[model samples]
Target: KIKEEINKRIKEKIKGILPGLLEEEIEKITSAKEEELKKGVERIIEDYQPLKEENKIITKLFRLLGDKTAYAAEKKPVEKTKIEIEIEWIELFNPYEVPCEVEGWQIKTSLGTRALGGIISSDSYRFIFNMVIRMPGKSIGKEILGDNGDTVILTNKRRNIVDKVSYRGYGLPWSAWEKNDPRSREFASILPGGSPGFRNWFWMPEVGEAKNKNDYSSFYVKDKPFANTGEIVFIHSGEWRTIRLEQGGEWQILDKITVADPPEKPVQGRININTASKQVLEALPGIDSALSQAIINYGNSKKRPFNEIGEILQILLLARLGSNGKDDDKDGYTDEEDEREAIFRGLSNLITTRSNCFTVISRGEVVKNDEIVAERKIKAVIDRGSSPIKIKYYRELSED
Candidate 1:
């Protein structure tokens, strides 16, 4: 009954203005845009069907207006709900600003939409969101924008669009991407090395610098060597640590990955796989102590040094690389390759023996729906070739 009452009132309002509105907008249909206008008019005309016999001119005039403006005179208007959401900051673009109030609003990206924890106070006039848009629930990916074109929409409780960002044609990526560095969201405004978050490391490639800065590294005795992180004998699968620099110019532990509840693969700047000790290898996913040993043994046995990281996948047969640069496992690939082709089968940014730069990829199991499951990849690079492995380049891989 309330809906009917609203519609009746809306119709009366439309009838009052239709005559003037039609005079302003009605046009002869010619091109595609004109045809679209005609269709919109026909939609409104349909609402007043009885007018076909009562008054043709009155019905035709409706074509000059939008469906809502023309047809409200005949049909009920469903009250469309509205919610106001303010885009606070885009981490890849405006990360330096204050974090957004993302409690209640829902964010949708090309990858998927995740709901906020509803932990924000909404008494203010606006809602802000610093949307990460990572996978929410059982969805597929978190890189929501598309290459050709994409739209990110913010909606309220009733799913009415509050705000949206739309882009068309092939443009810039949402984050920066370097050859061996993690493939970050290539935001249109962000260049390859420019940090949209207003921060970027000075590429320090010298090991002396890394040591001067008191960073961690494996001191090899020229072959039968191993690695340790100052305290641990060898890095464990979950032993990978995320560190940051302190004001005193020393490396400080920012967070450590817990085996029971590991964070998404912590990005490790490249640890020269060519020179990285077995202990270091053990810290990576799909690698146990035994596999690490085997990798070391295999390194000795190979005839030629790997030309590139992807070549190691072929040497270990972890992934069979055809000339075309794709994993051809359908012909019978197993083990890590068989387990998952996307991560294990390729070493695009890994497995380098000479560049003296390396990346460590780690994945952790997180409980989702009461079950432990694995998630995305992150990479970090350390260029030992530099006089002082400048700075460890680490970043989470964008899912686009």
Candidate 2:
């Protein structure tokens, strides 16, 4: 009877401890499985494509770590505005046959409106200065034009809108927007001191009318190599001779001098080789009239234009000879290839095969087992003239 009593007590004690141990073991297993599941989800979320609506559940669960980890995948870069130039004067052009009377008219800008009291002659230009248009109670000599962009509207005494123009200044010193084609109402940017009281430098008359280039003839040096002396050298004239600047910026041509040495610093602008005329090609150092013609002919022969600046070498070979591989230069060498190679190296940075403004599309893909798993595309507008070469526009294209 005594042994039976001891055995009953032992069984009760064993049962009590067994339930506790079982509960502890269950908790350990559940914790381990939950941790493994969480890690698997974390890996999936880490490699996920840029956040979409479908991944919100995973993104929220991942945020339990007290961080927005999903958004860190792709962060958009901050884009800055292009530098702008301020203007103190505004120009007005009259393209019609009859003159305009503006005694009781008003000119409207973003800042304020100024009363107009002058007559703009027919086929003429007029300039309004900043002091004349200063707003009332503002500081003396405030600029009328915005540094980045502005809209100028003109209205007559009857409050009828006469003309309005919207323009952006690209921070280029001494540049202004002027109508490029007098026949059309559209305007274009004119560089280096715009024509204030005369026709624009880039004015293109009607199709049959003779272009009056004499207005800008004083500023342009025809068929002359640049001397880095602040004078503008018009590149499209044939067989540019080396120009030496005399006193008062007068150009003295030296026929004996052929090649112009490269400037010490990289120039601000570049010419498109694909679109430049033969005369413009002659403007480069060591490129003569014969070479320029060869380039034009080579460009014409190719169905597709040059894709890169290096492709000019093929035309340079034709320039070595008269395109028939004969001794055209009469330098006693028929296929002397070194001369053309030197020219290519000299003109590389100054020339481009494309325009100043172009679009760039970039794509990226994740592939697995010969199949695309994920893909992304981005499009941007690249303006080469802008300083620091920032993207003017950007967008994420939907995957097709």
- Per-residue lDDT of model 1, residues 1-400, tens digit only: 2223223333333333323334222221112133433444454434333323433222112221222221223323332221111111232221111234454667787766757434333212122222111111221113344547666677767788755666555344333221112221222332332232222221111111112224554221223221111111122222232121212211122123122123343334555566778867755533555556766777678855544343343333332222324323322222211222222312223333455556777555578898866566677877665565654787777543
Worst window of 10 by summed lDDT in candidate 2: 59-68
Clashing pairs in 2: none
Backbone collision count in every prediction? 38, 0
Could you tell me the C-alpha RMSD of candidate 1 in Å? 23.9
Using lDDT, give the best candidate's number.
2
lDDT of 2 at 390: 69
Q: What C-alpha lDDT values do all the predictions have?
A: 0.36, 0.48
- Global lDDT of model 2: 0.48
What TM-score would candidate 1 get against the native? 0.23
